[model samples]
Target: MDALPDTLPDAPGERLRIASYNIRKCLGTDRRRNPERTMRVIKRTAAEIAVLQEADRRLGDRPAALTPEVIAQASDYTPLPIAKNHVSLGWHGNAILVRPWIELEDLHHLDLPSFEPRGAVAADLRRDGQLLRVVGVHLGLRTPDRLRQLGAISDWLATQTRLPTLILGDFNEWSATAPLAPLKPDFNVLAPGPSFHARLRLAPLDRIAHCDLWEPARTGMLDEGEALRASDHLPIWGEFRLPG
Candidate 1:
């Protein structure tokens, strides 16, 4: 396996790499539902933390597309407490996965208002004594609804005391800038690149928003040939600098 760059914190309280991917229910460009291919692309990111969108079936029992067993065998990662039912996976198709060594402190679900089912997953994690809040989300398609969802997320973030909060996932927005004015002055939004439609690579639908505690050192989309065949959207990752 090709090793991704070091995504771990440089020192005890340094930095880490966080990534986001909309796996499209593990359906590959070849028109086959391949969990192995999806996990292969995820492993390629070499991210310490990964936020996933569309991790479950859209209808029916909403069974998990990426089962825990497969994830364990494919990568050194584990899913956050986003799944409720034994067979279900994630909250409204949003899920969070963290490295095995990242200590989890708490986990919660943020229900966002939408014409369709939409929500966010919040994970309070500790690494080397540093606490980090990670929120995985998949916003709505409509502009107005997306704005409202962003507002709901912003309001919830206001009550948290964590310094470095990371918000990431499939935003479903087609703009270059995230329309999160309310979160401004407190959060910095980053779009790695055009991540949607991996074949054409036309839109920046995936993004990461973070608090001021850390600045992203580098960010980009993983569009390898295997990755493009794994899912419809390419995985995006960011390396952040630890606060001094």
Candidate 2:
């Protein structure tokens, strides 16, 4: 779709391009989710904020910690560890990034019920005086798991008050089934997504949804040049304007 507005203007009025991608732990689905490839997809998006799924420090029972040194090697965005599984093994967790112009504050991770430690990372930022809440999330892989996770998410989101908010991630959704069921009443999912299995190129694996967007103006994937080198999954992006 069209480039996300250099700025997103809601009430008060801030502009930003937001995106989501499942980096497959920085390894391409083809093999070892390569961190180099993962970072490539990220830099190409030129988004103000991003939510990444499957970034790994370690996986399975032996969760590894993602060090600052690891993130610095691949991306320009600061990496924040938002959730870890029950054993405290932090192998995989949500990743959040804000562009240089956007200032972020109040970063926190949500602890949801699941075999995995699922979370929602949120921050407050300003663009020309319009304040907004932005969230980066990666829900559980199982249906019941996501359902439970969203419940806690909804409860917290209900308290957001007037600022426009964003929720982006690897929702693991293909059809309107479960994902839409719980969060649709409160938010809008940017359309025409197929973000996984990059070499094959299907978008079911990635998505961007929002609350308080006026017309839901555009939706698309970034797959050109350096973006292709980023990861197995493509980056999905969108734009929103205030209702007149």
lDDT by candidate, in order shown: 0.84, 0.62
Off by over 4 Å in 1: 1-3, 6-14
What is candidate 2's lDDT per residue for 127-155, written digit by digit as tens? 55557777777777787887777678878
- lDDT for model 1, please: 0.84
Instruction: Go through the candidates in order and give the C-alpha RMSD of each one to the true structure.
Output: 2.7, 4.8
Off by over 4 Å in 2: 1-14, 29-33, 59-76, 80-92, 176-179, 213-215, 225-230
Candidate 1 TM-score to native: 0.93
TM-score of each: 0.93, 0.77
